[model samples]
Target: MKKEKTVTMGVDERYSQWKSMVGVLYDWLANHNLVWPSLSCRWGPLLEQATYKNRHRLYLSEQTDGSVPNTLVVANVEVVKPRVAAAEHISQFNEEARSPFVKKYKTIIHPGEVNRIRELPQNSKIVATHTDIPEVYIWDLETQPNRQALLGAATSRPDLVLTGHDDIAEYALAMCPTEPFVLSGGKDKYVVLWSVQDHISSLAAEAGSNVKMGSKNSQKATESPSVGPRGIFQGHTDTVEDVQFCTSSALEFCSVGDDSCLIFWDARVGSLPAAKVDKVHDGDIHCVDWNPHDINFILTGSADNTVKMFDRRKLSSEGVGSPVYKFEGHEAAILSVQWCPDKSSVFGSSAEDGYLNIWDHEKVGETSGSGGPKGANAPPGLLFRHAGHRDKVVDFHWNPSEPWTIVSVSDDCDSTNGGGTLQVWRMIDLIYRPENEVLAELDSYRTQILGTTP
Candidate 1:
């Protein structure tokens, strides 16, 4: 007994000594202003010689995510600036289009800079952003500045406004498919639809024709646009998570929430939901999106680690029939799910597991060279995956005009803010590359660097 106790004490002492030494080293590093390097991060490369040294070798790829691309880097930028007048065609596409339009920017974000305003274009005038608090900000890359707008609650308390949400809780926001209305859901358990055109027209009416685009004096003329609520649909018993307009009609929309229910609302109807189902899932519904091609079809991601497809006609406030299709391969919460804008059978899901998984509901499974799927209904096998994020994926969307392109954002490791990046990735590269080929390429890259596969 004595011998054993002595041995345990020696081991504990050694561990304590090692821990203390490590703490000392850590403190020393902190004192010297050192930080461990991260795998990757989003950065905009500047073309100006003064912006970043050694610029000739590589152009800062537009908004490239912090991923080691197979060959090159590309990035995209979401600039926060005042609106400009509707103008001639200014395409924001690949590098070819960037050269002509991006050159007009006065202040260019640099490598060492965060989202700070380092400079502005020569002709640009700064606009004040005091009273114009926005709840949700959306920028249409295709039309960009022309369609850029803000959304906020009409009845707001300055003390209660959160950065991205109004009131106590924010559930969802969706743009109308064919109309000028925007729908928003909240912890208040009400879905409100606001007319976009009305907000703009009312703002213009207030400006009294004195507002000039990009003019210094225009800030006073175009104060906060009154975004009074248009129509309110009330039915949910819990917090709303997502709300989306049905693709086929402007009069219809859908919402989901922590109540483990989904409700369909009609803008033209009463406060009651047009359709509702509280038994679709065993957990909170995190997101819901209508199929772009099918009005009856909608896809939902839930906290139960599953994605369910519902046929709206078969569901009501009472109950629902068997789902049209169900997917259950995610090991963590399904945070975001989106149907491919082009393909009816194809779609994608982003989860807390840090993977972007693609699926085709019509296909039972797919066989890779590794082997066939272990089960007939094993979630159709991942068509491809993007596991580059280091944390939970918060949301994602397919580029409005680009079918094969997608963008995903996630929660940061600290959970203090978002993934802190707006990354762009190509679905084609992930879908087409065979497993073996991808492995070989990754292995080659590792060997070329460290002389061993990582």
Candidate 2:
């Protein structure tokens, strides 16, 4: 299938975003009374909706000084005071000021999945978050006519929901692009196929709505999406760390786990794996991603401290047991690998090494005997590194719609240190600027707190 491409951002557009995000972070930290031991943060919807704007922010903050606290606070930076974050992150606030009933969607530490879904006549946004508990909460993040409602909707009961998996917690979830299905993998060694339409309808019924949102034949425009576990996949003997749908097929998906194997699955053929590769890596496979362009090309990062590429088309070809391409670069176990959603040529990896590196699949040259990459494996596809976090980079995402904008979340390293785990970053090259917006927002809020301080 021929793919349609769009114009990538020029240096000017990237520069402008770099200025906006950096200034926002500096201002946020320099002035606010952020809660200590901060857990998670993310970009929020704009308080004032523009006709069709392209940027967003708001967050949870750690204190400016080195002190760490145990409580969590959801601040909505858009409304001047701290606004609430999504449900799980905002459970403890007072009822009067409570944003939405997001409490029901509580989740623990896991990669946050924000996706741009186009189920209707136009595109919208939804964030799928996993918790330590069994469920994954799918909150409708943005609705077309009203963008300010994003925060409110995120806190309300999720638009779609799934619960079984019981005791085993889910670690990864990937939504299929062309269907109403989502794949979930977890510690239980089970992969579930959930129907978004069923989940949404469940919510609608609970609210006592007799309204028939759309015709039974229509796939979109429903009051609540279905949450049915339409299918179940089982094969791995250990914890399933990650699962991703094949870019080329709607029914086919791949799952990797602690069992040291990678299994390619196809729903059409039932629960059995279409292709199975045992001992795929030396250790537990932590993450897996299908190349945006080459559906047969799969990328896997592992506790073995190596990143390996597998080609299903060549599974029965030469080096049947070995990877098509294995690149070793990280000193620590690689936790995440993301093939840029916008540019098929580039991909990024993050790990315990506290660095995020970008690579080009086509330009990568020869590797050492141990399957590790040497210097300058490729060029201009923008092979580079960002050493911006002090702690391990848990997860990172290349904004689906914007190739240049990147966001990463990690564990905290303490406030005095100038780095972040819960942070936003860009691949664009821009000079760092000074901070003064705190004067307009947080500083004013704080000054009001310590009025006329000596």
Candidate 3:
């Protein structure tokens, strides 16, 4: 029998080389560690728990440097018996009734769907109660309470919860990035700016209402509160489907709707628009968003299968009819459009076609055209195509903190999640390769040097 001798490398040289490599890798990891986990893996528990909170609430807040971090949860609303009409406002009313998971119970008259939701002024609290009802539920993210106040501020509850003209009551609610006022647009073609100070005053009004409900021995009307409507904005010929407050100017905001026009108003003035884009779209404008990254740029999406970006600086001199850039590719109408908070040149648009188009504004050409951006041989890139929903995607929102993260919700025409479902996806999904070729190259180099697959 013959014995084989094993060869060994210099211990100090090998140890030094491995330690140096680890130090370099550690530095890279320290600078670019992944804060966002794999979308499908980490969000499963959150989505399962979503059954309790029915409504998926995604909240985004801008940091001092202008980056936005987003928070999501099953909206913490009560999951009473299916028969209760109040539960209908949340989600999956009919589906839950038929689902073998829930027990049967009594039912009440159905209420309207959510009109709008907003974060409270000056605090971390968020509210999403209906306008038609007397009660407005308020949730304080700071507290993480099981059940917060169903009734907002102590003031007298509103008698009429307003809805949009075409049954879309939450036509638009614009919150000033730096101020406390939120401008709410309604079905009546009117816009009202609700002041944060006025909201606190509402608390006093609520206390007064409680005193009236109580006997003499009860708590006195704590404080007398006086609130005033900033003024009603009136410009739209039909319902104002969306409204936005300019981040650059606290005194200005814009509204758009079925009219195919975008009306820019100085909120400090009466309802009239300071400027208008009378022909921005050929069809109904579904959504409007101001560029948080570039205060002077505005973007809009329409039912006509088009997305347009207006450079206010250029518009001021070029006139209202011109758009700095227009995008067109979706076979169906665009349902929602949102701009990246970190980069003004990059934006994402979602449509009924079930595809999300990301565009680099810098590369998008400005050639005169009849067919729009996509048809005209423009450089608009298809960042990614996501197709999980069996039906139309209602909304697409970008995670402010994570530039590449987007969350979307859709209707289940086939009742996939029993009725409707919310899906969270990473923009990285559009670009993620299962295997990193660069990492493989590095591994091969190490194998040759170390004489093993280290």
Candidate 4:
């Protein structure tokens, strides 16, 4: 108990220190308090772009206390542009108070606790959700009527259901970037795939209409459509933890699992894995992502407290695969790993240690003097550490529309007076910009401040 208390105190101190440096470290930040913990978070489409700020749709889940049904929340978030927020006022936020920047737009009373949410890249309003069930639920956000989340509310029916898994598939979910395809991994030790090509036109038509689809009390709300898996790949000896489709190809995808294996699948060939890497990690692999810009590079985070980067060209079906680089920065098991949308060489990893670390693989062997974190013992390529969350950062997503922006959620209900913390932040450009460029900018600023001609 004493040791645990000490650890908690240390975390509090680090968070306090980070809070003090927020004005200097972040260009923009919004801390919104959530009423319940969210296991997953994903940014939807940008709704509007104004001069000072942009309005975006945000998707998140509310794990409720059973007094009210769990829900998938659609929220509108106003993101302040760079240099628009006053530095001194940016850090002045109350932990328990909700930010004015976020407003609830719609609520879907989900059938169960939503474990994961993934928006289709082709149409952001189309989403796939996983629960403590074998099937995956699909929703058309534009057509779904907004419902008030109250006690004893009827569960919102999904527009479509993807059924295949024989056991609960709680977390692993992904949507194809090139097509309206969905993929999920389950405790049944199987990876399931489904394509919504047949329903896309109907959904698009419904979204364009002014009529709302259904109400909570409507029993004749048209029979919900259901689809079967196009392919069910089996290779993992244990539960598959996460999955991701290749950015450019809907036919190719990959999955990581508790079996410590990484399996790549090619739907064009067959359901069996085209290439399998046995024992890719020392522990259960929790997350995996294929680089969008460089399709050859893939990243996986594991229970071994490491994130490994692998080149697809080197992986084969024959032997244990070798990672090009192993990032050992997190103190606890990593839960999420995602490549930055704007930077091919950069990525972020979040873990149970209450930290989200940003890394640039291009800076592995360079000596300090770069703008990244500097220490003799610092892990290779670590650029910055975000210590905002008081507990585990379960999930985070990089904003593709906004450079260097991120939305991260933490399951810190126990520490923060019965709720979780959702933060949207972007580090100052000086942190990630080229060293020479930063120096030149600093010199220009100094010349202006001193009232001297440069």
Candidate 5:
């Protein structure tokens, strides 16, 4: 019995490693070989369902009691949805469309409630936040079931505003993990800092905020700009793709861009990079992220088809100038990468290949054989590969509450497949024991410098 158990465990480990290796190959083929877009599953059906009703964004927030909270954020584009423009497009699709299915498909999320939303802390609210091209807002999940936007409750207000690029916002905004401040970045080539107090007040005074293309709401009716932002951070040569604050320190943050540079910033001091490495990737560095458990570590994904990890502590040392570990396998550009929060040494990367490559740290030598090990004991080795996307994957988001769930976004074609589609993967289904209890408490108490939350 003992021997049999050991064999089973070994097979599982080997399989995990193989999956990662295979994923790299798939990414390479999808990116470089130019697979027919028609070869993948069509996203038209799913996207139509998502946008049928008046919904633009959907979010799931789980309660502590195991019940889940789901909310939809709708942008009132003069009614009849944005695509309809007038009643003509709506009528045409209904009458001339090839498909004959019409249910509240928009309301019912396929694959149902996401596993990433495990449970919210006691009394903690599930908030859905968005911005109107230039303006940012948050919606309280605890409010009415009608899914109203929380106009007055945002934690921050941005001094800089950019609606979107090519019809979509190429960047995303995030609330600093520790403060009421908000961080906004995108193809605009600048990362702007927002003040928390200012955001809440602006929403309260104005019934609704209009996010224009170039101008800001400088004219306040009654309140000032909540001490305003310290100042805007502008250094990226290209569009700022991503930004993240250190989980352990508030003053430390990171930003990556198309210029092939990953810059570390000290919010308390200078505007220039405290530390920077130029040409960090062969191509644009589209994504940068900090390890949730280890603040000193960071990850970057690039158009070079590789993911690299850097140890800040090591980078800050006397003369070290290169990444501590580099993982290479994908053939095409990598759009996104994330570290698994629930477990250490588990990370994933997504690419144009429409697959996810799970990785682990190891040290191994190059072997003159059929191919490299799917996963090895080096700085980064492929562990698992999940193929789910049908086209070029543009974004990947990991669930904070669930251990193995990941949500991805990709551009489909026009008509039913136009715009984009979201892919939710219940990775737990591929794991061993599936019933691990998720605890909300952290292993150590980190200082909360900004927010009023206890």
Candidate 6:
């Protein structure tokens, strides 16, 4: 009991220190307290853009207690433009108070606790969700009617369902970038693929109509259309933890599993893996992402407390695969890793260590910024660390429309008296912009302030 108290106090102290540095470290930050923990978070399409700020649709899940039904939330968020938020205002957020920038726009009482959420790249309003079941539920946010998440409320119906997995697919889910295709991995040691092309035209038409067609009372909801898998690839010997589709091809994708294996598949060929890498990590691989900007690079995060970068061209089907680089920074198992949409060489990783680290592979051998021995001991490619969350960051997503903006969630129930934490933040431009450009801007500011140019 005493040790637990000490640990809690340490976390509190660290949070206090982070709060003190918010103005210096972040250009904008919004802290919203959640009534229940969210296992996943994602950014939807940009809605309205103005001179100072833009409104966007944000998707989140509420894993509620039995007193109320679990819900998939659609929120409207006002994102402040770059260089617009004042330092004082950005630093004044209360950890316990909700931010004014976020407002709940609609709610779909989910059939189960939403474990993960992914939006289709081709149609942002179309989203896929994973629950504690083998089937994947699809929702068209625009056409779905809003419902209150009341106690004993009937769960909202899904627009479509993808069925193939023999066991529960609790977390691993992805949507194809090039087509209306869906990928999922599960405990059955199989990766399933389904194409929603046949349904897209109808969904698009309904979304464009701007009218709700479904029954509001979920109890009387009609049966949703179900689709079977186009392919079921078998390769992994254990539970498949995550799957990702290649950026340029709907037929190409990858899967990582608890067997410590990474398998690549091309649907045009066969149901078997085109290439397999055994023992990709010493422990179970939890997350995987293919770089959209540079298709050659792929990232995998695992229980071994490290992230590995693999070059796809070097992989082979006959033997163990080798990684190009191993990033050893997190103190605990990494839960998520995503390549930055804006930069090919840059990516972000979140872990059980309560940190979200941004890394740049291009800066691996660069001299430490501090030019000190202690700084030299730091990890090679780590560029920045976000330590605002007081517990494990379960999920985070980079906003593709807003440069460098991110939305991260933490399951802070044990530390924060039972509620979770949601933080949306963006680091200052000087931290990420080119050094020469920043220097020129600083010189211009100096000329205005002191009436002298440097």
In angstroms, give how far residue 172 of model 3 lies from its true place: 1.4
Task: Give the TM-score comparing model 5 with the true structure, all chains together.
Answer: 0.55
Predict model 4's lDDT versus the native.
Answer: 0.89
With candidate 2 superimposed using the best TM-score fit, by how many Å does residue 439's alpha carbon deviate from the native?
42
Across 389-450, the per-residue lDDT of candidate 4 in tens digits comes to 99999999999898999999999866665679999999888889888998999997986778
Off by over 4 Å in 2: 1-53, 57-124, 142-156, 200-226, 317-320, 366-382, 413-420, 428-454
User: TM-score of every model?
Assistant: 0.58, 0.62, 0.59, 0.94, 0.55, 0.93
| Candidate 4 wrong stretches, greater than 4 Å | 200-222, 369-377, 448-454
TM-score of decoy 3: 0.59
Candidate 5 local lDDT, 1-454, one digit each (tens): 8986685565446545544443222211111111111111111111222342321122422111113222232111111222223322222221112222211122211111111211112212322133224333332232313322232322222232322222222344444656555555556566666654455455546646543211234433232233345556767788776777776666678888888888788878866677876778888887788887878778999988899998887765332458878888676788777777766566778787555677654422432211234334322366556654444565565545433545455543421234334444333222312223212222122235333454
**Candidate 6, position 191, lDDT:** 98
Better lDDT candidate (2, 5): 2
lDDT of 3 by residue, 308-399 (tens): 98877665532365887777667678877778665667777777665556666664554422212234453364434444343456666664
Candidate 1, 183-291: lDDT as tens digits: 6677767677665456445445766664423233323333322345667777888877778888778888989998988888876777688877876788999889999
Q: TM-score rank, highest first?
A: 4, 6, 2, 3, 1, 5
> Candidates 5 and 6: which is better by TM-score?
6
Q: Look at candidate 3 and tell me the lDDT of residue 285.
A: 91
Candidate 3 all-Cα RMSD: 17.4
Q: Is candidate 1 or candidate 4 better by lDDT?
A: 4
Question: For each candidate, what is the lDDT?
Answer: 0.50, 0.54, 0.49, 0.89, 0.47, 0.88
Model 6, CA-based lDDT? 0.88
For model 2, what is the alpha-carbon lDDT of residue 330? 77
Which runs of model 6 end up more than 4 angstroms from their true locations? 199-221, 369-377, 445-454
Q: Candidate 1 — which residues are off by over 4 angstroms?
A: 1-166, 204-218, 221-223, 365-378, 414-422, 429-454
**Model 6 agreement with the true structure over 286-343: per-residue lDDT tens digits:** 9999999988899999999999999998876584678999998898999999998888
Best by TM-score: 4
Q: Which candidate do you rate higher for lDDT, 2 or 4? A: 4
- For residues 273-348, write the lDDT of model 2, one tens digit per residue: 7778889999999899988687878889999988888878777532255687787667689988888776676688
